[model samples]
Target: MATLTILKYPDARLRQKSKPVEVFDETLHTFLDDMYETMMDSNGVGLAAIQVGNPLQVLVINIPREDNEQYKEDMLEIINPVFLKQEGEIEWDEGCLSVPNFYESIKRFDEVTIAYNDRYGNEKVLQAQGFLAVAIQHEIDHLNGILFVDKLPILRRKKFEKELKRIQKEQSQ
Candidate 1:
């Protein structure tokens, strides 16, 4: 497995909506493996295929549970995932691998149920809350061409855009 390049915010390609994965074949497995490696290497809990320049509805998440020592075994490889239900609300600071050095407090569902196809083309449903719920919502948004920043208020989003520009300029120099 290889580490894939994660597309940063403001890249037009990141605004593109992803298509669903049709074939559960070897290539799909390889890509998912690479994505998992990339997400781990980047120190992110979740990653969407679109973030890696692949416009497919595939995402991987491994939000380590604090109580679990075998967290690595809990990695989820989701394909064509959709929200089955969402309820309650929680406000939490969220960060994205694609957005880089930015974290914003966003309101998200406190609990969520999602249905998805596994790597082997088996259907599965997952119920998650807390950090896992937040992570799932964030990654699923990428499948629909939505970024966390897009959920920000207008003023806050503008401020973030300015800050992002400054950072980009500084890095270039």
Candidate 2:
């Protein structure tokens, strides 16, 4: 599969809420493969369709493992996912594929139980924690037209604003 170009923050498309996948066909599968490839190519642990200029509720995640070779099976593909429940809370340094080279501590659920369809239209539920939980929430936010940077506090937000502006300037040049 070919890697897709990830759209950076402030792109109008990233602000648009993704549409749910209606057809679990080859096209959808192909898109998901490309998304995974793109995520790996960009060295991101997770990605959402909106981050790649597509308005679809699709996300891919592969949390880094302590033993790199053994982690190949960690990748996940979720389509039309819904957060069923969340419990407790944890603050973690979160980053986004859409917003490169930036990270900030954001409060998120320590555990999340979610229901989502697979690439083949089969349903699945996952109880996620730690980095996986954080990644899932971040990607879901993208599907809902939200970015991890939007979760930052006022002071921290201002700090990141300068970097974001610099990235935008570079993109336009």
TM-score of each predicted structure versus truth: 0.96, 0.93
**Maximum-lDDT candidate:** 1
The residue-level lDDT of candidate 2 at 143 comes to: 95
Candidate 2 wrongly placed segments (more than 4 Å)? 68-70, 166-173
**What C-alpha lDDT do the candidate models reach, one value each?**
0.94, 0.89
Q: How high is the lDDT of residue 28 in model 2?
A: 92
Q: What would the C-alpha RMSD of candidate 1 be, to one decimal place?
A: 1.4
Worst window of 10 by summed lDDT in candidate 1? 63-72
What would the per-residue lDDT of candidate 1 be over residues 1-173, giving only the tens digit for each residue?
Answer: 79899999889999999998889999999999999999989988999999999999999999876764326689999999989999999998999998998999999999999999999899999999999899999999999999999999999999999999999999999
Model 1: runs farther than 4 Å from truth? 67-70
Q: How many backbone clashes does candidate 1 have?
A: 0
Residue 170 lDDT (model 1): 98
